[model samples]
Target: MLAPLILRGVNFKSGIVQGPLAGYSCAPFRRLVWQHSQPAFCYTEMLPAKQICIEHGAFNRYTSRHPDEVKLCYQLSGCDPKALAEATAIVAAMGADCIDLNVGCPKAKIRKKRHGSALLAYPELLYECLSAMRSATQLPLLAKIRIDGGSNERHNLLVAQAVMAAGVDALVIHGRHWREDYSVPCSWGQVALFKERCKGIPLILNGGISGPKSLHALLHKTGCAHAMVARGSMGRPDWIHYLSGPLEGELGSLSLKQSVRWLKQHLEDLSQLESCETVRLQARSIVPYYAKQLSVDSAHHLVRIIRGSSDFKNLMLSLKKIL
Candidate 1:
């Protein structure tokens, strides 16, 4: 069995964490996860450090955490040291359990700003940014970085060493380069190599962990301290509970009716917490996942209904009909 992770004195009961998914890991989505699945830790969507530093209410949306989220880690991304430090302090003041620097987002827009995985190419700058954030607050600092800018193991190792040397509490490494497509297999061997190189700091393996079986296998294979679940758990909020095993009965025994009830509750919660525009977008994005559980014709019809409806009430009604 994998032991619980202890990062800078905070104890996480499970080794699994919900990785930050930009638009999807917002307040309402997190609330659903906490209420249903109960992952060891959860992260806010990546908020830009520069925006937090410049805009008055920029952190407002990200910081609207539920009371149940005791282990929330607010993730920030930026290339500027000063902005990062300011944002770290702001997040700490907002009662975040930990602060995570996002250096592994592979989006082209993020890379263009020299943020996210772009930092992997600039070791010295990444170290400086980490150091500045470390000095800004006493909160536990975590960094999420890619394996390398390219496929080179040596380069990945050097970056991992530098991240540790800069005083981060834990490291989350995605096992592929930023430029690589998701079709390429994640380098679990490279993740194992990182574990070998960075001995003491807790290494949380991100990417390629789709479900409980893969999570356990990766942990065993890499000797990683923790795993972060990403796209796998998007619409299926119960994934964490399923992985935790204690709630296996709930997942295993859920009938289609029960699943539909759960999906309805999730949609209702999102409607109450977010604006109509957000609800519409979320419905479009998440409904397809739930549709997969239904027959192909029904699923297609349901998606079309969800996509076409602008009103939340009509969308919910149409969804209920399908269920």
Candidate 2:
């Protein structure tokens, strides 16, 4: 159902996309996504406008893109219009295929900083920030936002209108309110409601969509042009292929042998981008996501090995022993 939709002038090879996850959607993981699912393009982790303005080219984990990530989109957050515009220009020069402004992040820390969903409360400022970003680059621009329930619906629509008026190439609408948690269901009605209001602009539906199949179903339900996969790609990087590629595999999960191989490659990719100390600490957290696809005992075995490993090289050796 997802055709190659054009934004500005870039062609997203697939309408399905690997959306940005704050901590998990780093360069190494996205590189793995590209090798497996190859859905449109993967967005880099959310970047702070002020941070990008200060550390545009430095060796930063959040800013590093894999050399193979040809169609990368940079998602930027901040309330400062100048900082966003400057950040936009910097990423554009850094080879961003498209840029997205994160207006839907619901984390309290992000809101308190007036950077994420907090900006939804001030339409005027968001409009200014977006307009400045628009003026910065001819490259495609987008804004991602969340829906608020009941009394706040009108204001939510206003924020959508504001970003559109500011010249975002498209909009990504999350079906839940900023105050709501993921445990709350993603309201397809809310996503459809935004589609009704912003009739002409291209919209990318986010939230609760795990991969291409559900994404296709959501598009039919909401009339959105495309969809973004978030939590669905955790551990199962090969998810999109089940929907559009070979159906021989059940439920899009890789085999345990394949999983171990991919996991090894993931760690190897991280080795080039981050130091051994960073990889060792991060591996403890990353294993659980991969563990999700494994049987309960296998998952536990993987986790224990990663957690008990004394060092980074030990971590790899332990993973190799799993097979």
Candidate 3:
């Protein structure tokens, strides 16, 4: 059974909530979390609602929850209220514990479609969308928003109030706006205001969270109930546990060889569930995250290892030698 976990008014099986990265939150990635980490809320890659209606098979795959996926969630992006709500209903019936509306994604395609952060400019429409979703299903609804333009504090506050009024169970705030790319910087001060406006709502903060020090600063300053991780958790599977508690003693700083061994095991598991092509892509995806922790040459070697045609066995062997 999924453990009972709650954030503000919304109850989930696990207090942990995984940040939905567009291409990376595949079944194998999510399954890894389900097995190794605490029972946590894991989101599917953002599925456009219209696509959900037309290609139900892909929707099922995107939103599919393993039996172990206790608090699985489907994140939908669209400008149409009815289509969005209808899609949410479909996934809910398919076994989603929560349905999150993606109003924070800043990707070019999503914005041009007027789906993601573009919705922030039309607050009333955003309200209507969430309200439609609220009317359609009893599953917990979450609204993810990036800080609005200009003053982060002001924009986030208004967005929070509107979403809360629309009856979302929780709010996930990315601490940066669409304009502020990841390279700029994060605004912890703005995040600290979340507890002020929506005292009863769970505000999960995202942005610039790379490790323990940042986590500690943000949590203490914001007084938020939970933290959502995005790019940071790519290769470091144990990051959440690492931040939430003390390190795993001697194994805390895993050597490069240890990392290769672990990653090879993860690759094998991924192969069982995904195509070789996908495994290769995912390996490419997480390599940079692991690369950062190693020396420059070792990092370059990791990149080569992921890109090369060697089988998973040879890849691990090569990484072991490089480390």
Candidate 4:
């Protein structure tokens, strides 16, 4: 039997989570995933905790969740405890079902700010941040961390222990060190080792889970409570359904024509929820993901047209012609 993942009394029936993609996991993308894939939960892109605390409208974009996104987790990144606490409170008040601290982002900008994966190097600060956030809300709190800050597995274990000790409800481990790139395979062995020490706290395994086969293998290997999909679900948001099995009334095996129609509907929904500029930018960014499913000529043509056009209607017309 597939065990459900429960965090703070909320039952995640599927145990398949949509990990936050920094620039791409915005409201429109999340809505697209929710409508098509129906992951147990979806996260917003990482928001800067300090900015969300200081700026009046900083969370507007992050908080624009779809009505169906009842299990949304707001992921926050920052080095300050006070700021994190403030931001957590605001996120909870904004109707977030859970809060996640981002400590696994390996981007240069994130590390330079001593946020994201940089926090792994300073266990004390990470604990303080988690503790503050825990005190701020009764909502489930989670920490998403890399396997190791340095090359040492011991560092990873220490960070996991500290995060759990700080009262975090769950841990999401991306099975790689901060210095390791995606080219390096994720170490599910390391995740399993960490899970052994986690006592009863739920552990969600992430990294390189591209499809159902890998997802199942990783789950069996790591004994993780859940699996979180990130880059793998890019153009194929229906991957969640493929991995978790389709929910009742969910469509299966979309044809190329149906996929194109779905893309059109996604763009239309995006336009209604976001500004024109945002719609155009998001459309351009996401269109390339569909290229792989198209013929070589159509793929190249789609990329060219999307890159050159700023108007959504014109872009859609070009896409329709190519599809």
Candidate 5:
């Protein structure tokens, strides 16, 4: 049997959870992830607390979830504790099975909003915000934070202690500092160290875990109870299944033909998506990520897609040549 994974208070007998990615967790894409049998849980793209609080319709647009999606967690980010609480209450009322407060993203736009990892400097505020949410909702809550460099050990410990004290059911620590770029390798050793400090609460290891070797190694090194996969799952929707078991025998990883076929299916189904441009941008944005794995014909298929000449027939024609 595959590993039965659980994180924070969310349990996944499926052993894997799809990591939330901005611009990727829209309804159509999430549907793809949820359809996979291995990914037992899914998270919405991070929504700002203010937006979730005030923009009910738009929040529903981002968070409208599928019935088949098991243990769906909506991740929210913002600096204000009060607004964060308000947003948590609203989403809990709207039927979020779990809620994750995102403090791990390091994007400039998110930082400018005083959200994501930028709030690390305000551990007190993070505690208050989490505590408020805990008081407001019966749903499970997870706090995600980036591990500051190995240098800020003391600060990281303080932050972790506060989060655990605030009654968060889980702590997801991305083993990288806010200042570090993706080019820098994520240190699983740091995750293990943090896990040691957070012995009682569930600690999930995040960052730089793209393949089986890294995933297994990190799980062993960090002693993490669970792992979250992000960029790894993009075009390879079966990434979670691949992680749960080796694919060298059954399907042996997705072929270039299979990838293109999936993309075509995604786009075809997306025609009925609520917003065409949003769906187009998301579908189109993924081409480059899968470009390298593609065969020659598949690569050109992406080029044509980028050129904005996509239709069901054109896409199928491009894919048929490759198949």
Candidate 6:
């Protein structure tokens, strides 16, 4: 159902890459993905360039990687080219297979820092940052971006032209504008515009891609060979498998019992990689996502139990009772 993707000189067994999710894309979640559905590559949560440069050796959620991780992309966020360049080299030394610039994040805090979607408006500065990072390492450098909405071709093209001119290896374009929410349908038409201007750079389509139907549709419509999944894979580590190839059984989220088992291991891995407080907090969000497979009343009951749990032991106990 998908083609093998080769970024720079690295060969990904499959072309369906895992998108970088903020808090959830850390070591434990990625470890689960590796054990369940290994995609072309998995991305780490966005790492602030300044933070990386400052705490280069410290172990934290953003910079930590599991021993099982093979093809990993370290995503960096910052406005200064020099700082981004430094951080790129830092991640390279930390063993990154790819370096991605977070140009698509739309959060107000990110925009306030002149990073993320804000960079779309400053094509020259974006070029400078990409150019600097490109020179900093020999790894494949990708810029993850979104369009400027319908009828805003000029702005979208400018950013596309800037990345290409700065000599990026590939373009990972999401189908929605930064201002829009996920409820708004993804605009494959705008992604097609980028495919036309790409010249030859490999374009990876992202946004609203949940399964084989959506994945195949995006590829067929926009002519992109690769796609990334975000919310679809939350708490369901096996979500990527359905898109990687043909499936024989039930689809989407795993059965309730199976999901509860997966969540047990996921929290265990999270405990090893993060603090006790992190495990408590992450369990709250993780349970509800995986609980979606249950009946509505059952799911609500499980989520309520999980959120009210006081500690790691309580969290595990609540999850066990679900099955």
- Residues 171-221, model 6: lDDT tens digits: 988878888887778878777667777777788888887668777877887
lDDT of 3 by residue, 70-185 (tens): 57778999989999888888888877878899998888888998899989878888988999898889988888888853453346666766787888878888878787887667
User: So what's the TM-score on candidate 3?
Assistant: 0.83
Better of 3 and 6 by TM-score: 6
Best model per lDDT:
6
Report the lDDT tens digits of candidate 1 across residue range 1-323: 45677887878787888889887787767877887776778999999998887773343556677666658999999999999999898888888788899988889999999999888888889999999999988888999987753565346866876787889988988778877876677877777667776778888887776556667778778766587877766666777778777422344534455546656776776666678677777787787766776677766776788788878888778668856
Provide the TM-score for each candidate, comma-separated: 0.89, 0.93, 0.83, 0.90, 0.87, 0.93
Once fitted onto the true fold, the runs of candidate 4 whose alpha carbons sit more than 4 angstroms away are 56-59, 149-153, 246-256, 308-310, 319-323
Better of 2 and 3 by lDDT: 2
lDDT (CA) for every model shown?
0.78, 0.80, 0.72, 0.79, 0.72, 0.83
lDDT of 4 by residue, 114-161 (tens): 999989888889999999999999999999998853375457767876
The C-alpha stretches of model 3 lying farther than 4 A from their native spots are: 1-15, 57-61, 149-154, 192-194, 247-251, 269-274, 295-301, 310-323
Residues forming the 10-long window of minimal summed lDDT in candidate 1: 246-255
lDDT of 5: 0.72
| Model 6 C-alpha RMSD to native | 2.0
Query: Ranking by lDDT, best first?
Result: 6, 2, 4, 1, 3, 5
> Which pairs clash in model 4?
none
Q: What overall lDDT, based on C-alpha atoms, would model 3 receive against the true structure?
A: 0.72
Error of 1 at 85 (Å): 0.3
Better of 1 and 5 by lDDT: 1
